[model samples]
Target chain A: MLTGVVPDARYWSYTLYGADDYLIPNQDQRYGYNAATMDYVPRDTLNPEASDQWIDQYQIKISADQQEGNWLPAGNNKALSITLRLYNASPTVYENLATIALPEIIKVN
Target chain B: MKKTLIYFLLFCASALVGRTVAIHYLPDYIYSRFSKMALSRPGAAVNQFSVLMAPDENAKLVVKPNPDFAYATLFYDLTDGPIHILGAMPDSIYWSVALYQENTVNFYVKNDMQYDSDTLNIIISDDAMDQEADIEQIVSPEKTGFVLIRVLVAERDEAHQKAISDYLNALQIP
Candidate 1:
């Protein structure tokens, strides 16, 4: 897992998609939740420190029993796709920061 | 009967092995050769404003502001493997980081919880620090490859914009 930082500017937010180009099943409601089912979860509430009796309070499951927000399935055998949307909210003139290309493959194994 | 069963099992195993070998070897051979050629050869960088692609290191990056033109982007090329982004921006600007797969224009992981707007302002203000954002999930199938970092600069003044551009150009994955 690699990490990067985006500085504070005006207004910015990102949206993620799965291999099928659909919104990954987000247990955390922080990312946009499903408007139809409203079955979204938040990360903070999952932590025990943040919420007392966290485990007792809620039982969560992704498409299957994998990581919390892991959009991909278990096993290193399959391929998945991902996408990113960057929104810049500055009131003035337009500015071009960067354009990123999606990876061709993501292997777990 | 026992001999016949053994023969059948052996046949099945051979067939399975053959299929697996074909499935795995063919794609590997094609991809490896194609990627080698693509990386070894020098080609024009894809994005116009600011883009970086390094096949040996297995990374690609693009930095473009939004169409509205409020902020700038620091996208990565996680085509082959993951890459880390480390840097800072001016004080009065707000920014966010996101992960996307190769060839797609969507985010794989949007860090709204960890580094929300309020959190970003504070973190950038206090001191110059570095953070890690894995792109494994976002760029699946690529397996352990590159990541995109989008940095939005608010000030957008002549000096700030120029600084942002220069900073992006100077980015090194190492």
Candidate 2:
């Protein structure tokens, strides 16, 4: 399992890709989820306040098994990489790409 | 032995030539096909930006399809002058315009945050990147190229997407 968080921007999302840069095919037909696609997350899961846009603080979960809130299904036994895209990023966000850090991943019981 | 050596040399020469030609012309061929795809779609026409994806929808604009940002495209010719882009993005949404040369080189790109504009006013030209223009100028290395605009659709707001589409349709090179 892997997890990460992107800073606040007008819009931001992380997409998982195979070694070839193409999206990893999954049964759900979902590649990634942004703040706008909150409906994809299970109802009332995670921080409800982080409902829209890349909030001040939030974590995205990626794993083969189903997890709650912003669950990105990683294909079985396949190596994948994530691409984070920030649209209309502020100077604070874009300039601090190196300085700012993504959230740490923790195993789900 | 002599015949085999001659045939082998000829084959090597032919393969090298074929590879070079493919490398040189393949980009234009691919770009043309994708540019045509953007043009022939419904509501799309030359010089005007057309939204390829609808709200809450995903599609193949050219090859790889993305479900996140809504793609709006324009196939433009700079034989006349420059095409002017003028509009205002809705508040709290992310958007960007990427200008690609007809031969498929991405020459310039700017997002809503980076752009020096409140009401979107930018010029697209092939003359030069530093040309004298009252508004911000985007130089397309090729006289003719494709302009791709991406606007994020917020939630199930089809209305916002429609608004942006209408704004894009109203833009024309003058």
Candidate 3:
């Protein structure tokens, strides 16, 4: 399980890559979940115009089997790595890149 | 017994030499080959931008490409002279331009937030030239390298694609 608060940025995503450094091939054509695809709701009073919409938190699961929310396939017994990309990041995001709260990757049986 | 020991020693010596040579030359050879392949694509040439669609599993031009980004690439060859990049950012989108050396080290990156103006007038060269007014000059470490312009298109919407494409196409090399 991977969980964290989304960074304040115009775009963010978690992409899964296999040991070969190529995207893990899956049937759903789903390799990642970006800010738009994650379907984060507005944080402040459901106001779409509010600037904090991108700051909503997320929980993603990586498994071979189909999962409920924000799932990316683990691609059938292969070593994997997740890459997080932040585009047009805010000043805070850039400055605190090292100290920022990254999503915790928990191994669940 | 003596013959076998000499043979084992010879094998180890060759293995070390082979490993050393491969380690020293393989990355450069691979990058050179990759660059040649990239430049051979349709509409991809020296000093010109080749706009690419959002990356999918088959997109090998870059590793770990973000699907939400529309990319424009320039396989720059600065042997002749300095190359000028003139462009304008599309409104309300995340945009950045990054410079990479032939060895794949990203040397410079400028995002939209860093620029005060929507329009960009940048010059990339290997040598110092007479400073031109109203243009930002960047010295490149390699005469031949790559330029990447990334524009965020979160939804893959048609309007966003068109806008990004237009923005990339408008970059002039004069």
Candidate 4:
């Protein structure tokens, strides 16, 4: 399962594309998802307005078992890379890119 | 056989140099071609938003378009005078305005987080300008280029898309 805590930025987007930058053709025509576009799958009890967890929590469940929030469709073996683009990002984000903390993409057996 | 091999080597060397020159000049060539095309139009002017034509599946002007963002461009020429771009505050959404130089380099840009306000203003000035801006101006070494505005659509509905398109189309240099 692909999961990560997205960075804090004015605008962030997670785009899953083929190895090349070309959009992967899909049945639903859903190529990727962005911060404004993606659904918030609740995993924590944190408030969006109160805390920054709204922009942090992200879990892409690969299993066929459906879950809450919005589905970040990366399954069906079509994705090659999930690009995280942070626009108007914090200065610290760029300063610490080499050591930035990113959640792991765990394998579900 | 030896003469033919030398001629082939000479040809390869010239071809490599030719390819390098073409590659290095490609961006400038494209920029000038497009810039002239844009300015040739009667309404082409600086600091104004011109909504690009709808995306054609068979053709593309730029490249790698995101359907969620509406694209608009402003062709600018500082020959007459320095132009000011003002008033494009995106309503709490993702937005970015970028300026490209004649050489196709992104010389200046401001995003929502950087400058999110009702009075979004930027003056593009060359070195010849004696006046100064109270606010920081977008300094451009090149006097000619284009500005692109990308606004993220909040909803995927047709009505919302149409609204976004209308909003984008309404944007112009005042």
User: Candidates' lDDT values, in order?
Assistant: 0.35, 0.67, 0.81, 0.65
RMSD of each: 18.5, 6.2, 5.1, 5.8
Chain A alone, model 1, TM-score?
0.32
TM-score (C-alpha) between model 1 and the true structure:
0.28
Q: iRMS of every model, one decimal? A: 13.2, 4.5, 1.6, 3.9
Clashes of each: 55, 0, 0, 0
lDDT value for candidate 3? 0.81
Worst 10 residues of 1 chain A by lDDT: A29-38
DockQ for model 1 equals 0.02
The segments of candidate 3 whose C-alpha lies over 4 angstroms from its true place after superposition are A8-10, A25-28, A41-55, A64-68, A73-78, A88-99, A107-109, B1-27
At residue B140, candidate 4 shows an lDDT of 77
TM-score of each: 0.28, 0.65, 0.75, 0.67
Q: State candidate 3's TM-score.
A: 0.75
Please provide, for model 1 over B119-153, each residue's C-alpha lDDT reduced to its tens digit, 9 standing for 90 to 100: 22211111223543431122234332223444444
Q: Choose the strongest candidate by TM-score.
A: 3
What does candidate 2's lDDT look like per residue over B50-161, in tens digits? 7655322134343334556666677888887888877666554667788887567788887777766546678877766565555787767777888788776554356766
| DockQ, all models | 0.02, 0.22, 0.49, 0.17
lDDT of 4 by residue, B7-79 (tens): 9999999999999878788889988788777666677655566775323222234444454567778878788
Tell me the tens digit of each residue's lDDT in model 4 across A33-53. Answer: 667667554544555444434
lDDT of 3 by residue, B1-174 (tens): 999999999999999999977777775777788878888887777888888867777877667667777888898988899999997887767788899887677899998878778888899999888899888899999898889898877765678678778888788888
